[model samples]
Target: MRWGEIIRRLVLIPPTLFGVAVIVFVLLRVVPGDPIAMMIPPGATPADIDRLRAFYGLDQPIPQQFVTWLGQALSGNFGRSISLHQRVFELVLARLPATLELALLATLIAVVLGVFAALIGVQLRGRRAEWIVDGGVGVLLAIPDFLWALILLLLFGVLIPWLPISGRIDPQIDIGFHSSFYLIESLLTGRFDVANALLHHMMLPALALALPFSALLARILKTSLAEAEDQDYAQIARARGFSRPEILLREVFPNALIPTVALGGVQITLLLGGTVLVERIFSYEGIGNMAIDAVINRDFPLIQGLILTFAALFIALNLAIDLVVTLLDPRLRHG
Candidate 1:
């Protein structure tokens, strides 16, 4: 990446995160819902509600409240969760690992399936093949992740009984460091049984996560490849007695990957935007779950913190993508 482009992206991240934090904070206040009313149990006296409001700083002016909360949050304080009755930071940290694991697992599955689809499209570039791939992508994209999760749960968990229905693991199983190795490492460690169980549990969610993302990546890759296929370099290379794979690999795929790299920023941003409903559907405890809880309970401070955290992540991921793009294609950085 050009040093300038890398620096530019780095510079842009903080302000963007700040903007998201402010927007979410203000918007939460704008929405209907008296935090005190939401927090207090029914039949509470007016005095009790007022005391609660004062305790949580709802009595303060909105600007004062936001600044005070923002200052504390920056110093690593997320305040108390009225619903969970725990420190918001601690609750978030506890639940974050499961969500991260889910995302990482899903991202891996998406990338692999997406690449596989791309390869298939490249190998079979005729009109019939294009139509088939297009139709598949369209259907997958149209189906929401939660619905897919429910269908898979019914098929694998209810009908087949081969995998547990939802939650990160079987409640009985202890998941410490021993649960770490999943694919090859597990096999090498003579933990094939555990590995199989892990994969079996993960497969449906992974498939659910993979389908929509793969559709997007495959569509992008297929289109890019199709365009690359017709470029003059490809024809020239083919005419010079180059092998088909050689021509495609050497002359096409590298160029095709540019669009993919460029769009990776939007994909990273989607992690926050797209994860909420799916996480709730699967009972997955990621930031989305945290956000949902905050919204339902009207935990203003916690909601702001969670949204800011997610926004920062989105900004950081986009910055990383831009940096990589600048490195791979310098034009992006200069412009």
Candidate 2:
């Protein structure tokens, strides 16, 4: 990528993210719910609620509320969660790792499945393969992540008893550096038995989240590959008596597949975004659930922080995609 394009990408993402954060800041206050009231004891008096509201600046006008939030946020004050009574930054930072782990693994799975399906579509050129792969991808993409999560839950959680019904690890086991150390320590110490159990627990939720994304990516890749196969370079390879695999890989795959890599860098954000529903169904502790709780209780500072954090993530990923695209496609690099 040229220096100019790199600079442009960096410029584009942050302002867009700031805009999203501002929208979230406005919308949360405008929603007309009072977190102070929600968090107050059931039999608390109106006087008490008013006191709490004023303490949190909830009694202020919307403009005042927004301006106060903007200043505090700019100064790195995340405030406390109204319902949880915890530092919002601490709470969210604690959960960020799990969400990042889930998103990363899910993206890896998506790339594998997507590229494989695309490869199959090219190698098996018949109408049947095309129909099966394309149609399946469509169906999978159309199905909601939570629906898939539930179905998998029923199958593994109830029917087979092969996976944990909820949560990320076994309750009885000791945790290590990562999540429940039960799994991580076990794996690190060459204990396949514990590692296997951990994998089983993660399998359903990961698959539920990954299936839709992978299917969509696969469909996009297949179309791109098919189009590439029809280009002059592919015909030239065929005329030269190139092997089928060689023509597909050496000639067609590189140009078509590189674009998918660029696209996947952007699509990684969607995997993180989709985790809201997925994590709730699985009862996983992550940023998505934290964000959900913030929204429910009208915790303005917490809400703004979560939205800003996610928006920053999205922008960073998008910038990475743009840079990678320019690097891979020389035309884009020069353009």
Candidate 3:
């Protein structure tokens, strides 16, 4: 909340990213796989393999590789994907919008669902409805995001056949996209049909990712709401002849939201991480999905780039959340 604290956190980002880069670089090489060998065709000579390895600098020692990679990364050159043969930065940039879109949609869904559940739990306190809401949240929290993806796929994509299960959009749509953000670009260009299609395809996967986070948010908010309800301000509001709903809306909800907002920020980071599996399951071409391909192909550069990108996003999101929380909470503003 403090300017000094914000500055300190901002200053720590580089070292955090560097640590992530170092760990990923070392871990990737330590794994048993030869990216160069994978790149070479079957029956290729050792000379062919060596040439490719040297070309990608795989011939270097581990320490040299780390130094070289760190230097290049600091300079904004993440190198090319060993498998895809494209610039790692560009590849990640292209896929980033999809991941962001998915994560944002999921977060929106989560906040809405969570807030609704929390209100229901609070309003119906000591009733069966509250118990039902709590039970549902518990069940949702018990399931990981990946399993939710599978369940949603089966229920919506196969059994019900209501939504398109795979890919960002239907390949048959034949729309020209000026940007990777299909939904935004479509809506901006007055391509409502395309936008609709994009949402239809995205809905199930986004919902899958949202459910677990929604459950968590609901739990946190419900507890915060309960605590807020017991605060002296709420009793004062009641003594002032305000209705229960008015007290909740005006006095308790805002107080409850500070903690909820903090938890929401943390959940969003987890939602982004969850996209790695959910995107793959749905064949969504986000960076998370690309990360899977990078790992399978042992594309060291691409893998490293993706991890760093995610790390940066996580750090930035946490910083933004801290700022927002500080602004929202008067006590924190001074502290």
TM-score of each: 0.87, 0.89, 0.97
Using lDDT, give the best candidate's number: 3
Model number with the top TM-score: 3
Ranking by lDDT: 3, 2, 1
> After aligning candidate 2 to the native by TM-score, how far in Å is the CA of 195 from where it should be?
5.3
* lDDT-best of 2 and 3: 3
TM-score between model 2 and native: 0.89
Each prediction's RMSD to truth: 3.2, 2.7, 1.2
Candidate 1: 10-residue stretch with minimal lDDT: 175-184
In Å, residue 296's CA in model 3 sits off its true spot by 0.8
Q: State the C-alpha lDDT per candidate.
A: 0.74, 0.78, 0.92
For model 3, residues 260-286, the per-residue Cα lDDT tens digits are 998777778899999999999999989
* Candidate 3 TM-score to native: 0.97
* Model 2, residue pairs in steric clash: 175-181, 176-181
lDDT of 1 by residue, 1-335 (tens): 66776688788777887788778878878889877776678799989988888888878888998898878878988778777778888777766655566666777777777777886877777758767877887888788777788888788878888776565555666445433333444557776776676666667776777678877888888788889989999999999999878877888888888888688446746744666766776665467767888888888877876777677677777767766776667576555
